[model samples]
Target: MMTMPSAPQLAVQASVKRADEILVVDDTPASLQLLADLLTEAGYVVRVAPEGAMALHSALARPPELILLDVRMPGMDGYELCRRLKAAPQTCNVPVIFLSALRETTDKLRGFTLGAVDYIGKPYQAEEVLARVRTHIDLHRLKTRLAEEVEQRTEELRLSSEELEEKRAQLQALMGFMHQVREDERTSIARELHDELGQSLTALRIELSWLRKHCAPLGEVVLERADAGYALVEQTVQSLRRISEGLRPGMLDVLGLCAALEHLVSQFAERTGVSCSFSADADDYRLPENGAITVFRLVQEALTNVARHAEASQVSVRLAQEKNSLHLCVSDNGRGFASAQPRQGFGLLGMRERVLLLGGEITIDGKNGTHIDVRLPLVKGE
Candidate 1:
């Protein structure tokens, strides 16, 4: 009757059949031949080296799947050779096993400390050698696979992050172009309203007055209707002026950022009755035209939010210049929301996009009151 090989024996048989190479380093010819023949008959390709230097040379030339080293060799012993093998980058990952007659626990411990995968006592058993060799080769292969997988994952994450950043940049550029288009449209519409509709209303009001003066004979009822028509025309002209200014303030183009912000704050105060104060570091210092327009729009949106949502009575707007940057702050003592709560409206989002387009930052804090702080670089087209 024939006995079946155990699981470990089976694994060794399977691995050896694949022709995995094993390096044997021993000083004694008898022991070296014994290990070599035993491994060869078991179906592994075996190579023998007389001492540590020859073993290291053979291993470096073409690293084996496993190394069986004699601990008692003269000069460079197994421990020293193991250290050298581990230090060299190419052979560092190869599994090493120590062979020795030393039964002391310290001797075995020293081998393990020097990175040997296993230590076998000599007079060695053939089966034990084959089993340990098989176990370690499997572990080394698994470790290599895992390392490769990790490296692949890291590279994938790096690429994904770069792609996301590029998309974000593209979105910001689109927003900036749209913002410019909208500003140009507003300027055109405002000009049309002021120059075309405003003039027509004014001329009609003058004609109504002339008609009333020339036709007093029409009596009190006709005179009263004519006066009513004149008043209505005057009211329409005022509305058109207000709407045009709101669309694109002509003062912003003529007077620059500081004057425009002052006018905006004054109007907000007068309209909302929300005690507002405006201040600036210098009246003469101004940003480029586009930057000034963005800042003015930022302040305008902030004040609108405060009036509509904050329900606060006191508001303060401040502008300052520092080195190459312009800083603007808008704060209100109103019914503030939680800082963690998300802003649901497009106003804050638009303000943030506008600031970012110019390579700036905006932060909104809603603690005791809502506070918006913005920093913009003064560089052209930044």
Candidate 2:
């Protein structure tokens, strides 16, 4: 009874069959027969061609796994045939081993120049021929496999890079939307504080002043209490204004980005005693609403960071326009941290996001204290 072959037996059979195909081209019938018999006995499926033309026709018809080409053939020589074979895309990768009587260095170099993988002398041993043929075939197969793997890996890397970029863009859009929402909320709250709460506090202060003026003659304790109440109301109003401005400065919307940035620098100097100097070359320049807000917020955040972390005595903020781009730089003589260190706070990240959303670039340098440089394209009508 016949039995089915095992998995290992089947694999070995397939490998042998896959590696058996070879083409032998020679002008001499005896030499062709000898090479064919040697390869066929060693389990290779060999095809014999009398000349270079026949070899080319056979290869183009059905490309063999390997070709043993003989030089000094009639009509077209082996070198010319090898060059032609290599030039053709279909048979360019097939390994060619030259079997020739010429053992000179020039002859070998000519064969190699024509893309031959190996050269054998005229009195070639069957074992040497078989060994060389096996070596080259294995090498060709390895080279082909490596090329396939490299192509696959390159494609995979390209796809991965595309996916990563897509994800980054999505994240950026999400962050921009969140920032807008936050700003809107801040604006709403600031308006409520400035209009409603501020007015209420002002009314309360007026009523207390009237009470102090009229009811002060009633008693010293009553007058003192009235004065204290008026003072507390005044402090509340001042605190409310400060809180509202901190949340979302009305100056930013009313006075535009440049004025808002100047105000910010002035406030920072006043509050932190940092001796900040702000200079702008394009004082009349204006930006789109979003761009203005982005610039204002970036300056605000940077100044806040400087106040909180930088133990600097002086800070310089400069704004200029060159050609079609706007440039802003903030530098401080602070005890700066390592710029290469991973940023830990949301301040720098938020600033970066804001700049990126505006199609701008920002760079931070800590080599000479902390320097933040921002470049933004000055869009027309903005």
The C-alpha stretches of model 1 lying farther than 4 A from their native spots are: 1-20, 33-45, 102-113, 117-131, 209-220, 284-289, 380-382
Runs with alpha carbons beyond 4 Å of true place in candidate 2: 1-16, 286-289, 342-344
The 0-to-1 C-alpha lDDT of every candidate, in the order given, reads 0.87, 0.86
Measured by TM-score, the strongest candidate is 2
270-362 in candidate 2: lDDT tens per residue?
A: 888889999998765655458777877888888888888888899999999877778989999988888889356889988988899888899
lDDT of 1 by residue, 51-156 (tens): 8898899899898888999998987998999999999998999999998998689999999999999999978788999898889988988888899999999999
Colliding pairs, model 2: none
Q: Ten-residue segment with the worst summed lDDT in candidate 1?
A: 1-10
